[model samples]
Target: MRPDYPLKTDRLVLRPFEEHDLDDLHAYRSDPEVCRYLYTHCATLEDSADRLTKTLTMSELTEEGQWLVLAAYLPEAGRVIGDVVLKWISEKHRQGEIGYVFNPEFQGRGLAREAAEEMLRIGFEDMKLHRIEAQCDPRNEPSWGLMERLGMRREAHFRQNEVFKGEWGDLYIYAMLDEEYARAS
Candidate 1:
């Protein structure tokens, strides 16, 4: 089994989801700007709490397909400004998917990328994963750009992967192998 792990970057700490992060979860998940790309649409405080509880429950039990979500806290501001995750783990492939969300208020600060880089390190080096992939709606340019900036290549474009808000949406898949990450770093 792949073990849960924590990673740290210069200005961010990538760690498991905590019960105390309810406020941060509510703030961003509820924002339309933030949830535009998320599978589940914008959530309310109650909804975020319900989802957080479910995630925490699965994490506590070490469920195989569950994600380990990390809150991006800015110490100087004394707030959680964003989150990153390593999810959809497959033991057979030794691989997983990575995703992140930043508070609209924190969008320009570079905190999300800082947090994601640390999670990528854990997924590649500590977990010994063969591949890490990220999928985003093609129209979400910011997220797609982030995948490229993180050294992952755009590997596939699945046309009309799903219908989002009544419109057909295409998904762009970006991926990196452990060897590729090591070479680029």
Candidate 2:
């Protein structure tokens, strides 16, 4: 139930994050454009390093559940270009959330979609999670579209749910059930 540990797609390798991934993560995560719609403030190299270290060690630090933070790597370059994370929302409820971020340079190439599909398959089939949810800022049309393409239904729209960069922002929730995925497949 450790969320399949690692997931893979045709052109991408999805594996657990490592400390060595910090520098590569800093390259894109520190960019303003990449963090814009993600509601993430700009990150310095140090900040990215901190985040990478924390993500890499989260599982070891916890005793109950394993939260997999995976890096998406290209086969040709053998470099990480994105990350996908599955966080256990509650052990009792058996609920979890899925999140991802990709380098802008690699956007629109279906890399995110491929990685997401792989993660979804693992989440539903291997993890046995009852509900898998994804949230995004409403302004991020592409991300919303990606959720739709993944067959997740828009379950909720919370207006002004968060304040980011001095302004209120809307958050859209998309969810898929294991049964729903099974039926779709």
Model 2 CA lDDT for position 74: 81
Across 1-185, the per-residue lDDT of candidate 1 in tens digits comes to 23344455777665556798899879888999888877887898889999778766433214448776667777777677787778757877888889988888877667777888877876887777899999999889989888998999999999987888788888899999999999988
Q: lDDT value for candidate 2?
A: 0.80
Cα lDDT listed for each candidate? 0.79, 0.80
Worst 10 residues of 1 by lDDT: 55-64
Cα deviation at 16, candidate 2, in Å, is: 1.4
Model 2, residue 70: what's the lDDT?
81
The deviation in Å at residue 7 for candidate 1 is 3.9
Best by lDDT: 2
Best by TM-score: 2
Model 1, residue pairs in steric clash? none
